[model samples]
Target: MVWFLQAAAAPALMALAAGAAISALAIRLCAAPVETAASAAAVLVGTDEHELDADDPGNLGGPHLRSARMVRHGAALSADLVALSTAGAAVGLLLGVPVLAAEGIITVLLALGVAMLAAAAAAVVPHRGRPGLERAALQLGGIIPAVLGGAAAVAAAALWIPSRYKDLRFEDVGLENFTDPAITGGTPTPRTELEPMIEQALTDMGQWVSQTDESQYASAFLDVLTLYSVTPNVVVAIALGLGVLSALALAQLLGGAGHRFGGSVLRAARTSRTGGALGITAGLGSTALLAAGGIALLVLVTAVLNVLAAGVPSLALALLAHAGLGALIVAAACAGPLLAPVLADRPEAAVGLRNAAAAAATGPRGVMLLSGLLTALAALGPVVSALQLAPRAATIWEDRSLHALTPSALPLLGGIALGVLTVLLVTSAVLDGARRLGANAVVETRASLLEGRGRAELGELAEMVRRAAAPALVVAVLAPIVAGFGLGPAALPGLMIGVALTAAGLGLWMIGAASTLENAAAVIGSGRYGGRGSWGHSGALGGAVLTGTLRAAIGAVALPLLLTTSLVSALAVSAVVGLSTDGTSHFLRWGVAALAIIVALTCWVIAATAPEVDLEDGEAELSTPLFARADDAPADTLAAMDWEVGDEDVERTPARARGKRRRGAADDDGRAPEDAKD
Candidate 1:
């Protein structure tokens, strides 16, 4: 490990330098356009001269003003980085394809060009000051693992290629025999002779294929499909999913370290450290627990599904499996966001969870469809890349065996490209999930405080529905049609099963993980645990860590059992009817049944538990009045009287009005001026 670290250091340092430079450049470029617009607006408004310099103390906005700008710029830069990285990775993979057709110095130059373009594109995204650049740099760090992982994958694939092609022999096609004669006779073979020999070899191969048995061809095709399409896709999905979790873990660690550093800096700066230490401890503990719990839950759920599918052969069981799985998915999704509030030391988090469930139950179709669509989009890149590899590898092997000395690098390069793209997609999804959950939690908490009720707000529910509606509709309507055409009836059942499991499992896992981090952060920021050395803080931290470990243990045991059950069930079913149309229909029926069961269970749960509003503790008093107006005077104050006065009564009217005003003012004040003075 030491040696590996040492070896990696050089590239790491180089990448760090490059990243810093790119960030600096990007910030300058991004700021220019925005700054220009700001200047133009200032001029248009005739405030150009009066405009406050960002560094001027008289500006009054303080450091927070610049910080807010940096955040906005950072977000924009982050989005641009996503797009740029995908494009660069794709370009690199595409460029590698030409390397197979022509291997030369130009190809190497082109690769260099691709790298340069990626870096340049990254630098082109607008950012603000040094802080904005630093943020961009941090985001850029995420792309490294993706790029390195892709390269490593490609290298591994390259090594594996020869084994797959080892059985093929050129002599069997009569090309080697024809070419060997001229060399054996000590005579140079003419270009014409070689060309004819290659043509004849191709013709003979075509003839052989035409004469091959249909059953043999069909079997071969099926073997290829299973090997290339089904198996690789499953493996890729699992591997990438694990990679995402690992990345999130690393990010959490980095964030914790940064938080600690920031706290130390604050302490050094003479800021109040009271409760800071305790907050950090509790936060760390909660974060660990959440991460562990989420991972364990995912593993356990996956294992159970796998076991049941594999172990149970009963058609009824297979049909019913989806309902159980769907229910779990719903439970996880609703419960996950509430974990945020839970970590915040709020007992009301439970109420939030109940409300979330109610919201989900009210719109199960939208939630499931949206979750499914997002899952599909996330997995699509990796799956397609996996499927493409088999055919690409086959083609490369055939071509290289006939003419080249080495395997083509295209497949592995493509894998690297796709892997990077997958990482970006997953990362973006995770970030988006966190943002949405955090926002939802804020909205729910505020609603509870103002309304004295913990019910889901209409705006929040509507936003959820709106965001999910289109995607859900597309996936619901299009997925089955695409499956029918692409996978065929026999394979469709397995595909559907896999999709359902993956979509539900992955969606829940992402939500849980994201929410956990958000909630933990909120707890720490809330400063409820006391200072650094406080017992409450330490205890919270310890509890969080313990929770995570326990969850992990549970998952470890649960997953294996589930996997065993699935495998056994699947084998039993196959033994009875095999993978036929009837078997497929049985699985489909089970899935539908599962959906129904889940919907019913969710509805029941929601109906049984209502959101309990806390009307006491001043919440009811804080509730906004139905007829409240922003411009209204104090409720105790009487309205001013408007009167018309004739000349004779003018003098008397002024005195009377002044006396009445004094009396009303005293009444509104709830005290007489003379009594207040005494």
Candidate 2:
């Protein structure tokens, strides 16, 4: 336990510190351009001849002046940080304290130590630069020393605190103590204690497999499902709906963040016109890819671990692998969403990849910390589910004497829900961070990329399909196929109905959710909502929130409707099967074929009608002094004067002929017509 704690604690603290420093520095650097622009505006508007002090708030003068100065100085940056940190901290405390309460003083000390170190690093790092991947890297480089120092301090404190508080069971912090039977709903047993039971179950499974004939394979499969009572129906619908809704919320958040980050990168590139911007954008994208790759690797590793558990039966090794897998998943989830929006905004794939990597490596530390904390919270459901299944497995082994037990669907459902929520929250945080960083970047940038309005529409649709595809396919295609082969002809119609309902519900939900998210993004990006902190921005955000909430609510309400429809369809098909006794099997087969066609056609239509995003031309709208203000005065006032015409002639003889007349006026004080009177 002590060794595990040491292993986990060190890296966790280091990452927390590093992420905090990076986030703080990114915040400052991203705001620099906005601040500089604001300062220029302040100088232009100053009525006094005296140079205004940029650093001194007192010297800023009047309310309007101060407001201008504050805006120029990146007041929104501070406000953003305050909001993010306050919310993040509240979430972190709520999740972390309870989870780590068993660790007692050690957890508190480690948290405090990490916080202090991160703060010091953030304070010491230089944050001035063009707000992009390269600048983030420089800031990250500056904070390395501070992070290392903080880690060392934490380690020293960890070592000393246990000695001082001798009563603290530091050794109890291992995996053995971490498992809770109450939460997991299983009798908590050590690997060594459960090894005998595992071996007995394996032996029984081997005997059963040996006795089963090839013709009885389908029957065996059906028996397994019957024993587990795992059927696709209303429960599946509810789970699918919840999962899709969560994914939609996440996509909305990530899309918004990506747009803002892209805007910032583009603005920075415009000001600097350097190749570095492209490199930075590519790096950010790569970082995101790397995070995604890590997730894929974790999935593979988890599969391998499961195989090992079932085949080789190494309890200790499996537990260790599980622990490691959990950590890796959390880390990947944190890094992936955080950098995804920044990378996705770039037009060039290579640029996005590089920038994502750089941002991941050197961007906001606070974001990383928050992501990690949230990931931990999201992981709770899966961990608890796993614990709950442990006892169920033991029961299967003791009663049925089966090595491979089909687990209840409840754990999987709970895990999916929790996973979706995690993704949503992480994406939201990422989007919010990107928005803050890019708030000022929008002022000078043109309406290029259509402000992500069009792109968001298409992106949201694609995102919905991507997120819901796996779960829906599993329920619709896989479940029915399995039931057809395993449960025989009678069970086919019920499974077919399940497939149809799942497909229809998923397709409908996807369209609705995508539309809502895209509309929200369009409203927020329109600038009608006052850009960042304005009342308009607030309103836009409110509208977006309401849209997402409403969509989720609608999905929830519609779940029962879907379930009821699926049941009726199944009942109708079953009645047909029973009535057509002579050709019941043929009738069932035709029914299944018809259902499959309907599902396929529905999916195709949804895909075909998905929104398309058109990229905007890069050209900026022209602005010149010639049209600085409206020319509202009379045309004659603006017309060029004929210098050859005398002043008296300009007002006399027809106004048109005055231009042809020479300078033939009388005295300066006399009437101009003195000469013309004759």
Best by TM-score: 2
Q: What's each prediction's TM-score?
A: 0.26, 0.28
Cα lDDT of model 2 by residue, 483-595, tens digit: 32223223333332332233223323322332333232333333332333333333333333333222222221122222222222222333332332333344454566566
* lDDT computed for candidate 2: 0.31
lDDT of 1 by residue, 1-678 (tens): 112332223223223322432343233223322222222222111111123332344322223224433532354334322322222222222221211111111222232333343344434433211432433333333334334433333233233222221122322222232222213243445433444444444444545445556442333332222221122222222322332233333333323222222332122212112332453443344344434543354444445434433321121121122222222123122222212221322234333232222111111211222222222222222222222222211243332211221124333333233323322332232233223333343334344334555232324432332232222222222232223222222222333334434333343333222223223332333353353333433333333222222222121112111121122222222222222222244455445435544543453344224232334445433534322222555555345644555667655667768677567767877879465334
Residue 373 of candidate 1: its Cα lDDT?
24
Q: What is the lDDT of candidate 1?
A: 0.30
Q: After TM-score superposition, what is the CA distance of residue 446 in candidate 2 from its true location, in Å?
A: 15
RMSD of each: 23.4, 21.2
**For each candidate, what is the lDDT?**
0.30, 0.31
User: Candidate 1, residue 75: CA error in Å?
Assistant: 25
